[model samples]
Target: MSEWRIYRGVREPHDGIDRLPDPPPWRDFELSGEVTPFDRHADALGDRRLPRADAYKAEERTIEAVNTALYLRRPLLVTGDPGVGKSTLAYAVARELKLGAVLRWSINSKTALRDGLYQYDSLGRLEDAGVARELRGPTNGGPQVGERGDVVAEDVAAAPASEEAHSTDLGRYLRLGPLGTALAPYALPRVLLIDEIDKSDIDLPNDLLDVFEEGMFEIPELSRVADKQSEVRVRPADHGARITVVHGTVRCHTFPFVVLTSNGEREFPPAFLRRCVRLHLPAVDDDERLRTIVRAHLPTAAEDADEVISKFLSHAASGELATDQLLNAVYLVSRTARDGAPSLDRLTALVFQHLNVTVPTES
Candidate 1:
């Protein structure tokens, strides 16, 4: 009857899905069965997994700026040195909002619009067309169609041509790129992690201005079909159209919690800067660093985690390595301890070996 994008059933195709913990309380919720609204995604902010800013020795102003931007639905442009948790903001927001995090679009010189959207397989399309012709050919006993009393060849040929029916809409099959998918109207608040935007070309940030402003794109390839044009809404993530054909107009959803991270490597155009809320993520101190380590690696004893964190931070302050690298080191060490795979003694050796930190040998 009506054209619709049917979401595949929630069947687990991998071991990870099978081993997933129970759905969080929010996941069980139903807002009139129409999917939860966007605002609901932010409701979990109060219970974010990270420790409160107060508990850490971090820049209170930076934390405040991030929170304010989230509450205000403004785009946050955070600039800092590499390895300084510039990208962690996205993860923190997702955890707080209870929505899953979509991360770093390692944008490079060649990355384009289609790279982020759903992939359209043209070869697959041709194969299907060939299969249809073979099956419906006269030798294969194709179905007969008739008006009232006679079997007409033209009627059979035109009988719901599946070969022609395959969608050619480049926009339709275009999977929502990370940024696009996050902005789509969904039951959840999407946390779009545009990591290392500084690495992107000069025109990339400027290019995004329109979509960031309007919140949507149209795919003519997918939406050119007469059947879809009349009925399908052309919404991303809906009806399997990752992109939409612009028969008319396209618009963006207003509140995606857009977060862009930069290493202060390049300056953005004024026009792009004006559209976003910019913040500087300053270096964190010992107390704050320890706090993050404890929060993420807790149940492994704060004292042990602190000891490792202290050493890494000491090295970072000396400019031996960057803060982001230290955080990564701590996370891995804590994970090592938590998983019961190693002792602090062994982890200390591994951390020094893998990270830039130095571990004083036994006396």
Candidate 2:
């Protein structure tokens, strides 16, 4: 068995599942369900949980952890094997609660916490400023009525910036990533999917603590110019929309619903563990695995699907194969079943082979 990195932090287990309140009152949401969550995609859900959804059969412990995270306004750290639906948990919750779209921030070895927050385009803003200066041609006139209506005549080069020009504040040059978008103030809390957190740098998780705890952050550029500008409409993760931040401060009305997924490839720090509600996802029973396979791939699969599922289950017992591989085998078999059994026993040998497993040849 692989070594599970032991942490020094005290374990904070989830209490009963009913501890969660009926959605935080601080957030702005159209109440619908018993505990309706903030949904970004209200139109997509349309009074339904999820349109194209399959049941996520998680154990009671896992469900309890989700509820606990929601109640405490903390992030959930889910660790499990690859293709074990760790990332899918975020989508499931968002759908179940009728929350809007899931804001996902996929992490990698080089991913930094700041990248997920916001990006300021200083160079681009500088270019735009230069263009504005160029657009103002030489005009020397004062208090003249033009054909359009009452027009102020002045030297274009010497004239002050218009209201539109002033509207382009420091925040206009900013684009919030998924993390920043989730943290942005909204009527309802957004479901933030931090996928593959284990692949991030060692410091990324620790860096996120301040934001998680405070439920807000500041843009240094915006902060510097805050005295000059009281409110700045900045672009967030969503396009064609702007969020007003006063004094360059963006605070969450409701703490974002964060779901951090890990593949158990690496261990997180003790401090990081303490801040999160962690859940260890285990492999499901073979029958349930087959059901997932059918739900995803062969929804119309005939009774013969059991034979292919059994083959996958057999290999899964002895080797390291993901559930997706089983789904793949089932899809191929069911699609071509009309042509007769086309060497499924032989196909499983090649189709379900694990990357690290070595199978001996006929000797």
Candidate 3:
């Protein structure tokens, strides 16, 4: 039994992560004593996506695997069927550890590595340059003089100076994505959820290897201007917030706790798998666990949830059904049971339908 766990799975906020031992030499970043600016978006305590403290019940194995990933400073690759709590695991860990916010990067087939890193608004910058040029007007025409013999057009030069500064401001055109924000040099590690990596392009997994190992990334737009301006303030994934990037590079003082989820949609490359700690979440098959989950989300309906759970288990045994379907059935039954609704049976039938099975309908 592994008792040296930092994330205890109890859903109570604690600083046990402070007790974690130093990382292996190969994984050490050596960026100690760096100061991170206060980010209200990352430090806020309330998140609607987080599971209720009293309702989520994580298995012992899940606890051990998370702690292992934390100690090793590696990402956790969670594979499981739908509704198996794979994605929710990241939020659970963030909530329990008092990690500010869970930065999420949702993946699709077109999602590239840079999509998670940062976005540069080149087109916007070009448009701003055009506006600045118009404001400066033509220098070819002789300077327009005022009624008192002062050059009014010369005053135009002063105005466009501010516009030229605005046009060349690289920070206004660049914003850090979720992955980039997670790599900011925070004293406490941020929780980063890379959801559905299996849905990404074939090369995306390979592209992330360098970033995961190095704990830093460079922005080319800012890099080109590094000679003139070494520090630039840019927005993070969280709106209305700004962070300073020095020398066009963003590095982590503390390695972030990363969770990559998959729906078993596709296989990953062997090299990519080698760097991540893996965890497979089995389906929620136990009757007691189902009740606990229901109670956590909807306590008022839990008293009569036994009957719904039994039917849910019976349907689950025959075909694939998500845990949320069970919760839906329980909520509807508890709400409509007092009315003696005659359509209760039909409603439950629709709620518990197998995900993989298709039923014929009338034309």
Candidate 4:
């Protein structure tokens, strides 16, 4: 493991990321050591319950693929069945290498490249502008007069400055999305999980090629006003965090470690595939692997899980069932048994149902 692995997947967090060699010339970016405080978005990113570092188990092939992607500074396209740890792979790598929270971009049918990059609240800005205008009087330059014909001195004094401040504050309405947050100028690369790419719009994969190739993106709103305001500080995808954008552009200090998961729902273009390192995760069918996973996640139930595991494997042999489903069954059975509840057989049956099987209705 010491020979070539930068990310040793033994479920132990380490500073091995520091040992990573320089990337290929084309992949190198200017380095910045500036540190910024940020709140981790683990909960919002849907990885709040990540498996304990001491519990996750990674296969040799998966480790090699991760390292290859890391050294080459390319995205890893992981295709596998649901609940087979495709998304968890990103979390595992981040845990082992001590990378900060994983930035996730979950895709849906309507997901576009910009959805992962940044979002500008133009409507919010416009509404704010309207409020500012109201604060200033109808005369275009003075405060509103009361019914008694007296001047509103406070409104007059505050309105012009408030309007000026709000009009120039573009950062208040702009935010960097997950992908954009991953490209922040950090000394160490952040781990990024682009989940379910197969569900994205047709053009998204091709759209990502340029960003992955150049390691930078531009915020058009900021770009247009770069001369007026050379720098803008905006919030990132993570909560309560801020990052600075210079000249309306963001260039990576290091290319993020990107993992794109797919469920084999669609095919990607050859050109897009050319830029990614592909890895296919094999199904977890063996009892030893299943037991290891069970122990990792449900240690209290490990002893009682054997019978449940056997039943799950038997059912899985005939139809599709996720690994999580097995864990769910084992957890319930173990809890019920301790509570002096009824038969484990019935509980297992309810929990281990096949995912791909559909029930027929009688007319």
Candidate 1 contains a number of clashing pairs equal to: 16
The worst-scoring run of ten residues by lDDT in candidate 2 lies at 1-10
Rank all candidate structures by their lDDT, best first, as comma-separated numbers.
4, 3, 2, 1
Query: Lowest-scoring 10 consecutive residues by lDDT in candidate 1?
Result: 1-10
* TM-score of model number 4: 0.87
Query: Which consecutive 10 residues in model 4 have the weakest lDDT in total?
Result: 148-157
Query: RMSD, each candidate, Å?
Result: 12.7, 10.1, 6.6, 6.1
Q: What is the lDDT of residue 22 in candidate 3?
A: 88
TM-score, model 2 to reference? 0.77
- TM-score of every model versus the real structure: 0.62, 0.77, 0.88, 0.87
Q: Which residue runs does candidate 2 get wrong by more than 4 Å?
A: 1-39, 42-53, 137-167, 292-297, 338-342, 355-363
Q: Using TM-score as the measure, what is the rank order of every candidate, best first?
A: 3, 4, 2, 1
Candidate 3 accuracy as lDDT: 0.81
Summarize candidate 4's per-residue lDDT along 181-232 as a digit string, tens digits: 9887767788899999999999999999999999989997788678878888
Candidate 3 at 291: error in angstroms? 1.7
Please report how far candidate 1 places residue 117 from its true position, in Å.
3.9
Model 3 worst lDDT run, 10 consecutive residues: 149-158
Give one digit per residue, the lDDT tens place, for model 2 in 1-363. 111211111122112222335545533333221222233445263433233233444555766787677767889999888767787777667665545677789899899988998987766655555455456544453323334332212233444668235324566578888998887776556789999998899899999988887787887666766766777777767562577777777777667789999988888889889989999887554676567546644567635678877787788877677776776777777766465656888778768887456768897
Better of 1 and 3 by TM-score: 3
**lDDT of all predictions:** 0.51, 0.67, 0.81, 0.81
